[model samples]
Target chain A: MNHRVLLLALLLLALPSWAVIETYQFDTDLQRQRYNAFIEELRCPKCQNQNLSGSDSAISQDLRRQLHAMIMAGKSDIEITQYMVDRYGDFILYRPRFNAATAVLWLLPVGLLLGGLAIWALMASRRTRRVPIQPLDDHDRAALDSLLSDEEKPSERSGGNS
Target chain B: MSRIKLFLPLIIFLVLVAIFFGVQRRVQTGDYSPTALPSALLNKPFPEFSLPTLQGESLSRAELPKQWLLVNVWATWCPTCHYEHPFLVELAERGVPILGVDYKDRREPALKWLAEKGDPYFATVFDEQGTLGLDLGVTGAPETYLVDAEGIVRFRYQGALDQKVWDEQFAPMLSSLEEASP
Candidate 1:
């Protein structure tokens, strides 16, 4: 047990030494969690489809440090996000704000779904409204019966001759 | 009415296609730099930071020139800054005061590069940690900001500065600022 504990401690110590660990001091666990979420929500401007937390680029690193400083300085979430947006535009945010430029992006899917439902409803209502064939009247029934009898009599006479 | 309705989506699609093609042509012709993110510091007061100059003297917003000046964010490691060096040298020789922000670069290499390439700046601030750069919203090197007499950022230009870019973008604003000053 003593040997196993020593080996485990050695492994843990060696693990951290080789890694480039980024440490940020937060006043509270809540603050640290907020910082993590904020960084994940921010897109790295220099990278392709990468959040600031995942990006190791120089700019992303600098931005992360700046964000840490701002959070430590007691800035609110709105203030921090606004500061980023003011510097990098709305492109920095993972969730883009609703604006004139992004209106179509937000509304197009809803519009398409409503349109499809409208078309489906129209087709269904038209199908229900279609007039089914009226039941045969008495006169038509009698005529159909006489026609059938006349055809049967000929067949019967042919059978007798055969 | 139903016929028109039936063609509405097709008409909308065609219009969208035309708009897309128009934008594509504009992009292909290099009318806009899509990768160049817009600077949000325009018309805002320059961020405050006191940094040491190459000669070990402190530099800050208070010491900035009262007249129009250019603050160029550059580094020795950035190749585009080297490409823009000659143009900056020319501008400096023509009496334009350019304050260089040596962004996240080593002091020795920065000094050596200036000595070799000819220093175009009135003074270069050494920003080794990039703290000042973060405050300035600088994501990359080779960005130039034109500060008005009052130290407000009037304009920002990203990428390498060439004669045409200077003539078209920077010059007009510089002249206007000069005219409005006195």
Candidate 2:
């Protein structure tokens, strides 16, 4: 048990060194945060699914280096994003721009949810509005009294015999 | 009204299904290849840069011909460039002036390749560091740009250029630009 615990500890200790080390330097914490956010926002062109920070492809590495250079040179986020978009098209952005081509993609989900809710509410209201019980009429009251009397006379005769 | 309401979701679903198949069919038969990325530099002036030719001559945008030209990005390491090289040689021989941007390649091997295969470019600009290539929005080698007389970029095609690609993508654009030219 002790050996197993030591082995696990050693493995955990070696894990950090095995990870890929990023060499980018930021002057301030805010700059570093912005860099992280920017990379997370941008998709890696070569990898398709991974973001720039997560991709280990050569193009992604080059882009990261370029991003660092631009950030150090005081380029704004918009300028950096625009630079990438110009080269790679709008596909590089995780948050696509609102345009005619992508308007349906952005609006469809909300429209679907609203439509579903409307249908659900309509169904619920229809279910609640069941036909009300009508008041007993004079004819219905007379028929009910006669039925009760007939049942009571049979029971009375049986009770007297008992 | 309720009947229509009940069928509303089905109607939306059918419409979505139609759109999906339509897009799928369009993609399967589309003219644009998946690897071909649309350049934002279209209709804009070519990025300015001064580069040294492989032959030790300094070349710049001002030195380019005041007529239509093709700027082809190629490298020694790109295999597709080899396939497109002979076509370029043919175009060059037929009096088409092509400016070759040797992208991210060493000077010696590029010179050797040119010597062995015969040079197809009017002037081959050395972009060993790929700085000018980055400025021009070059994602990879074998990307070609068609520039008009005013140094304006008219069309960009990414991938190996051949007779079919030239006929389909570049030739039409070139003729239209020529027609529009005074």
Candidate 3:
């Protein structure tokens, strides 16, 4: 394929979504930022892994329009999320809410990290805390004496020579 | 306590394996759908829509046939709908009241497809712009919903429908829905 042809195709592809979104007139910079955050956060129901901003799928187009309408109507972030969730369930969210169904997903890794640190602290504290040594019993002392006999003989011979 | 700690990694591994096998079993038995989403409107009333039917006649929520029925969503663009057409015709012949939604499809092609394939629905709602589908949380075509007599959405099945799916997944629920009705 020619470079010119490839570039033309890409240009044409970018036209659709750009046309719709540019037509939207946001009142404030904060509202514009919210729109950007929203399209990124909301997952396209029809497409896998493509958020609303990335995909030009039919569902995404309709949802983008609805989201714009909601934001323009002064609906809060929570209300917008609730509206999407009510229709599409938690599947539409890139970041699912912390709830009974998703509690494990949200909490498990953090819980593991904390639990591991706690165990490490416990083990480390235990290791550094030295216990007092008991005096050697008579049997142990005799065993130690028998083990040192070879070196003791040299000392004995040296003392005799002295 | 420390003795059990030694087997903690082993326990975690075994638990993970068990969960994997459990999910695998569910997948095989069709209890879990890894791709198709469970409908958000489960046990809720069907979304309100006043749309023209396939024949261009007006219809509305209050005018819905007050009984246990299947609301089948399909489109000419979806190849799976073509595959499931015969099964739908068969079910309709067996006295199943099926309402169709022509999802995001041109009326001419949809009508042509139905005429050629043999129409299976009692009333086919024409949703050309897919507004009704958007309200219903449709991801794509060839989805089905079971609405009880009270207009509550009892079940939703994504993808094509067939006898095996009907017998295993839908039949028991349909029976229960009927039993519960006065």
For all candidates, what are the clash counts? 0, 0, 0
Off by over 4 Å in 2: A1-22, A99-105, A111-162, B1-30
In candidate 2, which residue pairs get closer than 3 Å at backbone N, Cα or C atoms, i.e. clash?
none
Q: What tens digits encode model 2's per-residue C-alpha lDDT throughout B83-157?
A: 999999999998888999999899999999999998999999999888777777787788999999999988988
For every candidate, how close is chain A to the native chain A in TM-score?
0.67, 0.71, 0.59
Q: Candidate 3 chain B: worst 10 consecutive residues by lDDT?
A: B29-38
Give lDDT per model, in order.
0.88, 0.86, 0.90
Interface RMSD of each: 1.7, 2.2, 0.9
Best by TM-score: 3
Candidate 3 stretches with Cα past 4 Å from truth are: A1-28, A125-162, B1-31
Backbone clashes in model 2: 0
lDDT of 1 by residue, B1-182 (tens): 99999999999999999998988897786566667766767788989889999878999889888888999999999999999999999999999999999999999999999999999999999999987787777878989999998989898888899888898889899889988987
True-contact fraction in model 3 equals 0.77
* Residue-level error in angstroms, candidate 2, position A14: 9.0
Best prediction by DockQ: 3
- Of models 1 and 3, which has the larger lDDT? 3
